[model samples]
Target: MTAFSAIHEEHESDKEDFTPGVEPQPTWCPGCGDFAVLKALKGAMPELGRSPEEVMLVTGIGCSGKLSSYFESYGYHSIHGRALPVARASKLANPGLEVIAAGGDGDGYGIGGNHFMHTARENHDMTYIVFNNEIFGLTKGQTSPTSPKGHKSKTQPSGSAKDPVRPLTLSLASGASYIARTAATNPRQAQEIIAEAVEHDGFAHVDFLTQCPTWNKDAKEYVPYTDVQDEYDFDRTDRREAADMMYEAETKLHEGEVLTGRFYRDEQRPSYGQEKRSTGEMPEDHLAERYFEDDPEFERVADHLIDRHK
Candidate 1:
């Protein structure tokens, strides 16, 4: 493993550049919304001029976890609900690497909820995409955190007594610099939002509504949606305004109305890495490359110096 260095050759690339050859077709079921996420993500990378080598995708265990295998990039299919920690470390190790963490709602908003809050609060420079399918699709449709109140599943056969989580609002409250919601139903919108999220400087959260058609039959395909930017006019940079807007969107979503698009953006705040660098806490030389001679060329130089001194 190349201990997560970011320097790479920039070149022309396309969506096909990210697709793996000789890999099995994605196992997502017919009409599965996970396809939209893959498509949008593939499209976003090309448009952002990022090559597969320049990106690091970290994913947690779930149907979404398989995404790392399909996308031809530096990837890690970590254990359940632990993608964020792995991704945060990778980004800190290689600040220039475009890091994207992905997982299902249960894996992210439920099991890894604590990591999610702290990561957002610290404003790590990376993108976290939550596949909000409303239920655990790969695990036989068990009721999940975002599942509507009264949503019945194998775990909650009669009906779920818990209310769904307000993910977007929670992202805001946790101090995420950029927050948005996009559905797999709208591929173009999903692509645009993902591209923007990838470019954002701080913790960018996209609560993606990817429907599990095979398991979650009740979730609205997330269409007939409203883009907060285009339909509901408001200043995206305003914190209080963004909070109010997120609250409304979260409330309406469970009521069967799909609200998608950018909710909050704060370009002024520095990312965690940037803050450390500004405060002189970050060393001038990358620790992995300098102290450890992790770079091949650096190892050669050290070996030559030792021989000369002998």
Candidate 2:
């Protein structure tokens, strides 16, 4: 069978399919919120009927970056804050691959902020999950972009005077077609949100509130989080309503009131890949399939190069 077809072969899949046999154990600290993301992803894969081979898990440098090692899939451990770009390229090359990028607040919202904004603006077909613990967990509790104003950390000893980045609002402003927030303390909701994000055909951003118990001592475990869909009556499909609701949720998070759920979705818009293909800029065939399939143009180029070298 061809490489592309082989990986996309139909089969009965379970959560175990996403677990690496050689490295099944994760070294994350006990009570670490990163573990919840791993669980939610593994759980969501089975529900989506997506085998590990059909998925690409890209992660950036951070405690959350270890996800690539634990999950059995086409994994890429990119440099700090570069996960989104890598994921975007992979999805563009192989539109069939289910691409998911993951990183911490520092890696994504801070260092990778530019890429994140543009990718959403273009509406790339992929899922991005940011582990927002308010502080940089991997770098020993430094003040992150999402850190609350006046929040003191080792890096911000005098308490940070800058306000935190509102991720949901920023996502909406950047034109992300799908946006949501979920907490590590609520695995069921996290899994559900992940499944929905994966099913989305455009840019899907999930601001996952993961408490870093080891570094963030003052941050709560994100418990008592209310699902906005269950508690509030807001039209998630309406941009104005979603914006207002997201603003309220962002404000509430700092005030110790946690609101979690799908905040926005726009299904009418097309994904980046769709736009490119519609414009005849991107090919319908998967780029990786070139090696498995014969093409006269590719052969002509190869032969010309070989003759010149010889």
Candidate 3:
């Protein structure tokens, strides 16, 4: 099997003890955005008023994916770009769980981009946090999907010619119920936004601008977390206005002039789980049993195989 599949299989058997306390120290770089994101999520958990068992953290392959092991909750460290799908399925299976999907720009916007768009429109009751550092740190500093054009990296030594993907704008256009932006340096703001996202009833997407000191140093120096200020027209809730703000912030060339705050929140649409329950189908308490009973061919094959083995 592939290395990724092996890691996932190993993770399935490794059960972490769920104890209540401060979040464990992270293994990321000293100034990495992941540190702040982890802190923010840890701080927000108390406000959520949910037990560790009630929350589920799912993450894709990347720096942010390590978050699954840091939190004192049920966590799924899935394959690259598959965090959202696993998180969505978990939430559907147990609608009471507060599911959150975390990953880097490459994992979410590149490999998981299609799933991201569909989940937003479906309005799943979950929160998606993308740590966008513009470059792939794990792969020895390669240009990622969100890397700015002309930014030099290991993959593009002469600077990339393709324009970076604007995650906020794409999220806005994807019909996300809630959209927000924050800098990983601003722990307070990140905490607040994460709390709000968990509280949001529909699909929530937060684009967290993270700094990768190892890669994209130029961009990192340009937008130091402390340099950014929470600036946005909070009074504007119109979708068009939010879309405009997302575009401007993404395209603006000023250093540390990026806006940070909640851009959009719409609670009009019902979540997928809610809509599914409305179909009048009785919920199955024993999914495993139902699966075996509904497929006689599989059951018979399994019995025959067991008999032959015996």
User: Which one is best on lDDT?
Assistant: 2
- The number of clashing residue pairs in each candidate reads 0, 0, 0
Clashing pairs in model 1?
Answer: none
Residues 207-284 of candidate 2 have per-residue lDDT tens digits of 999998898877779877899998899999999999999999999998889999999999999999999999998889
Per-candidate TM-score against the hidden true structure: 0.91, 0.95, 0.82
How far is 32's C-alpha from truth in model 2 (Å)? Answer: 0.6
Model 1 backbone overlap count: 0
Candidate achieving higher lDDT, 1 or 3: 1
For candidate 1, write residues 170-213 as lDDT tens digits: 89999999999999988999999999999999999999999888
Would you list the C-alpha lDDT of every candidate in the order shown?
A: 0.90, 0.93, 0.78
Across 1-310, the per-residue lDDT of candidate 3 in tens digits comes to 2211221121211123333346566678878878778778877876666556667899999888888778888899999999999999888766667899999999999999999999998999999999988888887789999888888887899989998898888887887989988887677888999999998988999998888887768666334433222444433368888788778777773334666777788877788887877885525332223344534333455788899999
Over 4 Å off, model 3: 1-23, 221-236, 253-256, 281-310
Candidate 2 stretches with Cα past 4 Å from truth are 294-310
